[model samples]
Target: MSAPVCTIDATGIHVPSYDDVLAYFQTEFRGIYGSDVYLGNDSQDGQWVAILALAHYDSCTMAAAVYNSYSPTTGQGAGLSSNVKINGIARAIPTHSTVDLTIIGQAGTVISTGIATDGTHRWFLPSTVTIPPGGEIIVTASAEDAGAVEADPGTITTIGTPTRGWQTVTNVLAATAGAPVESDADLRRRQKVSTALPSLTVLEGIAGAVATIEGVTRYAPYENDTNVTDGDGVPPHSIAMVVEGGDAQAIAVAIASKKTPGAYTYGTTAEVVTDRYGLDHTIRFFRPTAKRVKVEISLTALTGYTSGIGTEIQTAVAQWLSELAIGEDVRYFRIAVPANLDNGADSKTYTLTDMQIAFNGDPLGYVDLTIAFNEAAFADPADITLVVT
Candidate 1:
C-alpha cells in the first residue's frame, strides 16, 4: 500500500506543512520578547507607529496592519468611516555595531509603544503595536550602546500590538545593549580601548601563561600596561605569574619589587628573570632550537640567607622546590652545600628560594628552582623547618 499524499513527498517522505514552519520558528524564539507578534498598525491618528513592544505576541505570527477613522457631520448628518492600510513593517539593523527600527508602509499607522528594561538594559519603541497575522517581526537584535560596564546595550525584543481607533501607548524605553546591530559609536569606543600595543587578545595570552596572577593583572585595567610589555632585565620580556596568599595588592607590589632587583646576565644569550609571582627564575634561553644545552640552576644561597640584594626569608625552600620538579628523576631548586661555607656556620637556616637544575637540547627548558620567600617571609617563618629534596 502507498502512503497518504499529505504524508509522502519526493522519494516517499513526510512533507512538513506551512504550520510546521511556523511552529519551528516559534520554538526558536520562545521566551524571548517580540517572539510573537503580527505586522501592521491599528492606530487612529493617520501616523505610522512602532509595534515592536507587545505582550503575548511573537514575531512569527505577525502579518499586515491597518488603521481606521470615524468622521461626523456638523449638525444633522450621521458619521463616515474610512481606514488606512500599510504593507511591510520591518526593522533595519546596522552592519557592525548599531541597530534601528522604523515604521514604513501606511503613514501614521504606527504609534510609539511604551518602553521596558530587562534589569540590565533598557528598550524603546512607538506608543503601541499592531502586528498582523501570518507575518514575522524581529525579537531581539544587538544594539549599539557600547561598553556599558554594567550594561552592554540592548536589542529589540518585541513590537507591541496596534488596535483600531486610538490605541493605548505602552512599553517604550531605551535599551542598554542591542543585538543584530552595528553602530559607529560602539566601534569608536572599542577602538579606543583596543589601541594599546598588546591590544585585547594579548590579555588572554598573558592570562593563560600566568596562572597565579591572572586576577590581579587581567581583572583591573590599571595594570594592563605591566602585563603586555617586557620589563627591562636579563630575560627581556616574560609574562609574570605573581600569586599572593589571596590579596591582589600585595601580589602587585611583590612583582614590582622583584623586577627592581633586576636579573644577573651570564651572557647576551642567557640571562635571569624572576616572575612577578615571586618565582625567582634563571631563564637562560627561550623558544629553544638546540637539541640539548647543558644547563645548571643553583639555590644554595637562596634559603633563609641575606645577600647584597635580598633579606633572609625562607623557613624551608627545599620543600617548595621538590613539588615543582616534574620529571622526579631530574628535578628542582634545592639547598646545595656552599663552595666555602662550612656545615656548622653554613648550617645557618636561610631561604633557598632557588637551587641548581640541569637539562639539555629540548625546547621545553627544565626549571629546577628553590623555594621562594616573598612578602610575609620575614613574619611567616618558623625555626627548624628543614628542606630536604
Candidate 2:
C-alpha cells in the first residue's frame, strides 16, 4: 500500500518535499514571536509527518474543516457556550477563603489588562463568580503581562483568573451536631467542576507549539486536587480550580475552602507599623480564609403542625433554598412555647402534606427533596397541608 500524503493548510505533497509548508508556518510564528518553529511528526504526533489529525478524520475534508487534533489534550470549544451554570461546593475556614473568576474566548480578540474581545463585544473574567462560606470580597484584573502582547486576533489570554476569597472569620458559629463541614473528597469533587487549563496565562510559548511545522509539543491535561488543612470552626478542607471546563465557579468554590487553612499577612505592610496613608485601601487588604459547602434544597413537610402565627412552611423553604445557594446565613423554625406544649386546647394533629425540594441556583435541572413532618408534640393537633414546587 502507498503511504499517506503530507498536507498543510490544504495543499498535499509527499513527505520529502514538505519544506514549503514549513515556511508558511514561519510567517505566522514571526508575527507572534520573533522566531520560533516546533513542528511534529505529523500534525498529530510531530506536526512533521506521523499520521491522522482527528482521533477519527475524513480525508476528503481536510482544509475546510477543523484540523484532526484529537488527543488527551485537544481543543474542545469549537462552539459557543451553552446555558450551563456549573455547580460545585467548598468548605469555609473559620478564618478566611478566596474566590477567583476568569472569562476566556475560545476564538476571540485580545485587549490590554485581563479583558479580551471578539472585535465586537467586551468580556470580563468569569462573569459570574462567588465565594463560599459567604462573605464580602474585592475584585480586579490586569493583562497576563505587558511584555507578551502580540496575540492572535481572536485568541489573546490572561495570566490567572481574578481571585477573591474571604478571610479573618471572627465570631465562630456553633457547628452543626449531626453534619459537620464537608470531607476532603467532597472538596475535590467541587474543584473538578472548574475549567482545567494548562496555564492560567495562555503561555506565549504555546503559539510556537501550535504553529510547529514538523515538530510537536506534548500537552498535559488540567487536573484539580483537594488540599486538606487545619480550619478552626469548620473541619479543614481546600481546593483549586482552572478554566478548562470554562468552570471558574467550581474553582472559585474550591480555592476559597482550601486557601483558608493557611495563614496570610494582613492587608498591611510587613513592617508591623500601622499605615495612616492607606489602611482602608480595599485592594491592598487580604480576606480571611473560609471553607465552602455544597448545598441542596429539599423542603420538609410538617405534619399536624399549623403556624398559629401564619407561618407558611412552603414559602419559607423556597426562601431558605435561595439563601443556601448564595451561601447566605439562614435560621428558621420556631417551636411552640412550653405552656402550649402537648396538653392544651392548642394541642392538635398537623400533617405536613407535601414539600417540593429543589436547588436555588439551578432550579430547572435538579431533583426535588420530599419531606413529611408529623406533629407528635401536640394533643389532638389540627392537621396542616402544605405544597411546594
Candidate 3:
C-alpha cells in the first residue's frame, strides 16, 4: 500500500489510490524480472496479477481504518460506540444517575405527575412516585441534568400534570447533583491508567469502582492512618473519599463492592448500602459544596454591536462557567476570554468596561472579585445581568 500523503492543511490520512498500487506492482515486476515490458490490459496473466495486488492494497487500507478507530486522537474515535468500547474494556464506564426532586403541592390535592417537559428537551421521570397531600415525595430524573436545571432553579416548568388543580408545584430542594455521561477524552484517560494496576486494594481500584456508579463526576480517595484521633468515625488505616456528584446509595454500593474486606470506610457523606451479595455496608464520602458566583457585566458596544449581542455574551459566559469541574478556580480575567465572544460577526464588537461578582447576594468588592475555590462553581445566564451601552 502507498504511504499517506502529508499536507499542511490536512492531517495525514491513508487513502491508497488504484493507480499508486498498480504502479508499485509494475515497478516490482520490472526490477525483479529485469524486463522493460509493461503489463497489458489484453493479457489475462497480467490482469490477474494486477487484480491480486489491488486486493492486497485494499486489505492494507482496511487495516489502517480499523487501527485508527481504536485511537482516541483520531476522528473515528469520536463516536459514542467507540467511547463505550474503550470504557467497557477498561472497566471505567461512567454511570449516569437520575436527578431527584421533591414535588410540593397543597394538601388533599392529587397531582398527575410525569417527566418535566421543557420545549424540545424532556426530563424523564425514572419511576412513578406519588406526592402526599401537603407533603412531598422524591422523584428522580430519567437522565443526569449536568447542572443545567440546577443552575437556573425554576427552568423545569412542565411537570407532568394531567389536570391543573394541583395548586402549587415546586421542588423543595435544588437538584444540584447528577453525573453526566463521561466525555471521550475522559474515557481515554481512564482507559490508559486502568490497566496499569489491579483495582483490588489500591486507591485507583476504589476510584475506578466508584466512577462506574451513576452520577459520580469526580472522586479522590485518601488513606489516613496517622489521624487515628480524628473524629467522624475515621479509624486508623481507614479509607475516605472526597467525591462530587452521583447518588449516595449508589456510591456507597460501589465503594462496598470494590473496597478490601474489613477495611473501614469514611467520608463527609455517608450512606447505607447492600451490595449484590446482600452484605450491608456504611460508606462515607465527601460531596463538594457548590458556590454560585453571580456575574454582572457592563459592556460598551462598538459601532456594529447589536441588541442580540448582549444575550449572546450572557450565554457564552454561563456555558463557560458551567463547564468547569470540581476543585477548579473561577478566574476573574478568564471570564472575559474573547474567543467565544469575538466571533468575527457583525455584532461581536463590544468592550467589557466593568464587571461585578456576588456570592450569595452580597456584592464582592474589587479586592475579592476572584472567587477561588476547590468546590463546584455554578452560574446561570439569567443571573448574569448584562447591560450594553
Candidate 4:
C-alpha cells in the first residue's frame, strides 16, 4: 500500500483520511518488521498502530481547518467573524422590537417614566415625556426583552405604569419586529456588499453603507437617474430605499451622506438629518410592509415518521420564508428544500408529496408569489400547514 500525506496544491488543501493514515502505518510496520510477522486487526501491534495513526490524522485535519479559516466562504463561527472585520463590519446582535405608542394625558402632564404592555410583552418608554398643548404625544417604546417581540395595531393599550394624569396608551401601527443574532451566511453576504462601499456607483455605495448599520437585517436601494419618473414611481434623479429592522435616523444619515447632490429621496418614512453646517434635510425612505405568507405541505409518512417530524418541517419552512431579502420573491420550489431538510431522520421519515403557497389567507396555489419591492414576506409556524399521509 502507498503512504498518504497531507498536501496543499493549486486546487486546495487535502488532508488524509483516518483509513488512509491507518493503512500507511500498517504498510510501514510491514516494511520495518518481517513481512511474515502477524499484523491482524486483533493483534497488539495492529491496535497500537491504529491509535497512533488516529492522532496523526487529527493533526492533519486541524491543519486543513486552520487554512480554510482565512477565507470568508470557508470560515465559520468565530473565524468568519474575525475575517469580516477587514470590511469594517461585525455580526449584528439581536435587538428589541419598537413601536410608536400614542399617549393621551392631561395638558402639562409629566411622565418621568412609564411602561406599556400588550399582555404578552412589556414595552419601556423613554426617561421623560411631557404632554404638549394637544394632550396627545407619540413616543417610541422598545420591547423590554430582545428578539422578535411583536405588537399589532392597538394591542398595546394597557398602561403598565400607573402614573398621575396618564390616561391611555395604544399603538396605531404594528411594532417593528426584532431579529436574531446574525448567522454566518448573512455575515458573508454583508461582507461581499461592504466591499462595494467605495465602488463606482453611488447607489451601491449607499447600499453598502446601509448594510453596516446596527440591527439592519435587510435592505434594498433603487435609483431613478433618468429624466422622468421610473416604473416603480420613483421621481427622476431620486433614490428609493426599502429597509427593515434598523434605527430610522441612522438609515437617513447614511443615505444623506452617500446620495448624489441635489438628488431626491422617495419613500413614505421621513427623518430629518443634520448636515455639517447644521442644516436639517428631511430624508425619505420606505419601511418594508410585512406580508404574511401561507404555506401548505403534503407528505407521506414512511417507517420512522411521527408528529414531531411534521412540526420540524413547519419550523424549517417558516424560517426560510422570514429570511427572504427585501423585494425577493417567494419561489414555489425553494420552500420544498427546507421542508425536506437533510436531517438524519428526514429521508427515512417521510417524502414530500405536494407543496403550495399563498398570500393574506388566500387559497393556496401552485404558483409563485411576486412580492413588491417595498413589501417583505413573513411566515409563522402556525400558518404553515403540514398534512401527513
Candidate 5:
C-alpha cells in the first residue's frame, strides 16, 4: 500500500488533498483486512482513517510552508526578515514623529526638562536647551508617543514643563509624521529595490543605495539625463532624490558613492561629503512635503454594523493613502479597495455608496488627485470622514 506524498518540481510545490489521502488510506485498509471488510462511517476504522488523513494533509501544508520560507517573495514574519538580510536590509521598527519647535525666553536661560504639547500628544525637547544670545532657540522635538502623531504649524503652543525663563513654545512647521512597524508588503518592496544596487545604470544604483540607508522609510530618485533640466526641476545630467526619513549625512554619503562623478545632486537639504582624496562635495536631496489628504466615505450600514467598524474603515483608507509612493497619483477608486478589505469582518458590515478624496483645504471630489514628484500624500485617520446610514 502506497501513502499520499507531496511533490516538489520545477513548477512548484504540489500538496496532496485530504480526500486523496483518505482514499489512499481506505484502499490500503481494504487490501490488508480483506476485500469484503466493512469501513462505513460508523466503524472505528473509518474514524481512524479520517484522523490519519487530516494529519497527512497538515504535514503536506507544513512542507509547503518550509519550501516557501527559503524565498523572500513568499516568506513571512521571521523567515522574511532572515531572507532580507542578504540584501543588507532589515525590518524597519516604529519611529516617533519629530517637529522643529521655537523656544523663546530670556538670554542665557537653560531648560533641563522641557516638554511641549499640541493639546493631545506630548513632544519632548532634548536633555537641555540654552537660549542663545538671540533670546530664542529652535530645537527638534520628538513625540512622546510614537507613530504618525501630527501637529500643524503653531499648534504646539502649550509648554508642558514650564521652566523659570522659558516663556513660550510653538512649532514652526508641520510635524514630520512617524511610522508604525514595517509591514511584510513594504519590506518585500524594499528588498526588490535593493537588488538594483549593482545594476548597470547609475540611476538604479543610486536609487538602490539610498533605499537601503538606515532609518530611511520611503524614497524616489529622478534623473534628468538630457542636456537641459527636466520638467521636475532636476538639473541636466543630475539626479534628484526625494526621501522621507534618514540621517542627512548617511543619505549624502550614499548619494555621493553611487552618483556619477560630474553629475549634480538637487534638493533642499544639502550635506557636505569629503571624498577620500580630501575634496569636499555637496550632496543635495529633498525631504518630501507631506500633503494631507481628505477622505469622505458614505456607506449604508448592514447587519453587525457598529461605530467601531466605521472607525476601522477610516483607518484602512488612511493607511492606504500613507502607503502611496512619492509622486504616485491618488486614484479615485483606489480608496475603495482598502475601505472594503476584510478587516476582521468589519468590511462586511457596510456597503459603500460613495467615496471621494481631496487635498487639504480642497473640496472633496470623485476625481484622481495628482501628486507632484517632490511631494507625498499623507492622510490622518482623523481626516477620514465616514457617513453611515
Candidate 6:
C-alpha cells in the first residue's frame, strides 16, 4: 500500500501518526480489493500485514523531518564536542615547561594524546571517550616519546625517576563529558522549547542567547529594579546572571549580544566582548561560586542493603544534588529518597533518622540550606559521609 501523506505538527515539523497510517491502509485496501479490511481484529492476516508496513513507512518519514528541523544557525542544534579527562605526572621536566602525554586504552592501544603545561597538572582528552554501559576500560598514560627534549617517562618504565619528582601517571578524568550525537526525540524537544523570542533585547532573550552557548548547563537571569542599594549587584534596570559551566568568554559575548544597550551588568568577572558589528562592549557576568556541602546521614539499611550500599547511597545523594538548579535550596527530606541498590530486583528503603548539612566543618543546625543568588551548591561523593548503624 502507498504510504499516507505526512502532516505538520504545531511546531511546523512534519510527522506521521500511527493511527493515520493504519486508517489510510484500511480504506485503500477496501476500495482496491472491494473487501472489508478488519484492522481492529488480530485474526485478519491481510489487514495486520498492511498496518505493519504503513507504520514503518510513517516512522521513517517522521524521523527524517525531525532530523532536518535543526541546524547550527538555529541555536537549538547540537554541535560537535565531547568531554574527557587526562591525568598523569610530569617527570624531571623544568618547573614551568610544557609536557606531552599519551592516553592508552585497553590492550595497549593508543587512544589519543595531548600536551599540557606544568602547573595545572591535569588535562582533558581532546577526543570523546566512550565507555560502554555497565563496563569500564583501563586507561593509562605514557610521556610523549619525542618532542620537548627533557620530558620522558624514564628508563625504569614502571618506576619513574623519583629524584626529579617524576611519578607514574595513570588516571583520567572527564573534564567535560562528551555528549553523543543528539537523538531525534532530544532534538525535537529542544526545537519546541526554543520558541522565537519577542525581541533579542529583553531579559528572557539575553538568557535564551546565553543558554545556546556550549558548555553552559544551567543559567538564571535576574533584574533588580529596587531603589535600595545593596551589594547584591541588582540595581535598578541592571541585569545579574548566575551561570554554571561554559566558556566564560563566550558567555560574556552572548550577554553583550542580547542585552539592551544602556542596561548595566553586575557580577564578578568582567571582559571586553566583541560583537558581530566589530564593536567592543565590556560585559560582566557572574559564574556560580560552588559552595561545597557536606551531607552526614544515618541510615538503617533494609533487605537491599549490601556491603557496597554505603557507596551506592553516597553516589545517589551526589547525583541528586548535582541536578539541582542554581539558587535552588537543598531540601533536608530529600536525603531519604529510596535508592535502588539491588540492580533491578529489589527496591531498597532506608530510615534517615538524623541528617545534617555542614559548611566549613560547621553544622548549619537547620534542615534546608539556602544558596545565595550568586552561588551554586555542589556536593561530591567524597563529601557525603554515610554512617549506617
Best by lDDT: 4
TM-score of 2: 0.18
Model 5, 6-95: lDDT tens per residue? 898998899988889989988988888887877778989898888888888999999999999889899999999999999899998898
TM-score of each: 0.14, 0.18, 0.58, 0.87, 0.84, 0.54
Tens-digit lDDT track for model 2 on 132-199? 22233223221232211112222323233233332221111111111124334333333232333223
Query: Which is the better candidate, 1 or 3, if ranked by TM-score?
Result: 3
Question: What is the TM-score (0 to 1) of candidate 4?
Answer: 0.87
**What is the per-residue lDDT of model 3 for residues 1-389, given as tens digits with 9 covering 90 to 100?**
34433222245456667677777777677677667665788877479759977886777777666656655555234443454454554323344333444456554445443666444445655344444554554444543333334423455566654544443334323455443355666666555544533545567787776666555555566676674745434568888776665665677776776777777886545566776778767777665556677788887878877767777777778767766766567777777773237554743587778887666577654434332223566667786787668
Tell me the whole-model lDDT of each prediction, alpha carbons only: 0.28, 0.25, 0.59, 0.86, 0.86, 0.54
Q: Give the runs in model 5 whose Cα sits over 4 Å from its true position.
A: 98-145, 153-173, 342-348
Better of 3 and 5 by TM-score: 5
Candidates 3 and 4 compared by TM-score, better number: 4
Model 2, CA-based lDDT? 0.25
Which 10 residues in a row give candidate 3 its minimum summed lDDT?
A: 1-10
User: What ranking of all candidate models by TM-score puts the best one first?
Assistant: 4, 5, 3, 6, 2, 1
lDDT per residue as tens, model 4, 1-389? 66676899998899988988988888888889977767778999988898889989999989999999999989999999999999999888888887767889998998887899999999998888787677887666889999889887889999999899999999876788887888898899999999989999999999999989887887989888899998888999999999886667688899999998888999977767899999989899987877889998989999888888788888888889988988899999888778887555575689889888999658889998988988888888998998888
RMSD of each: 35.4, 27.4, 9.2, 3.3, 4.2, 13.9
Q: Choose 1 or 4, whichever is better by lDDT.
A: 4
* Predicted candidate 5, C-alpha RMSD: 4.2
Q: Give the C-alpha lDDT of model 6.
A: 0.54
Error of 3 at 364 (Å): 3.2
Q: Which pairs of residues collide in candidate 4?
A: none
State the local distance difference test value for candidate 1: 0.28
Please tell me which model should have the higher lDDT, number 4 or number 5: 4
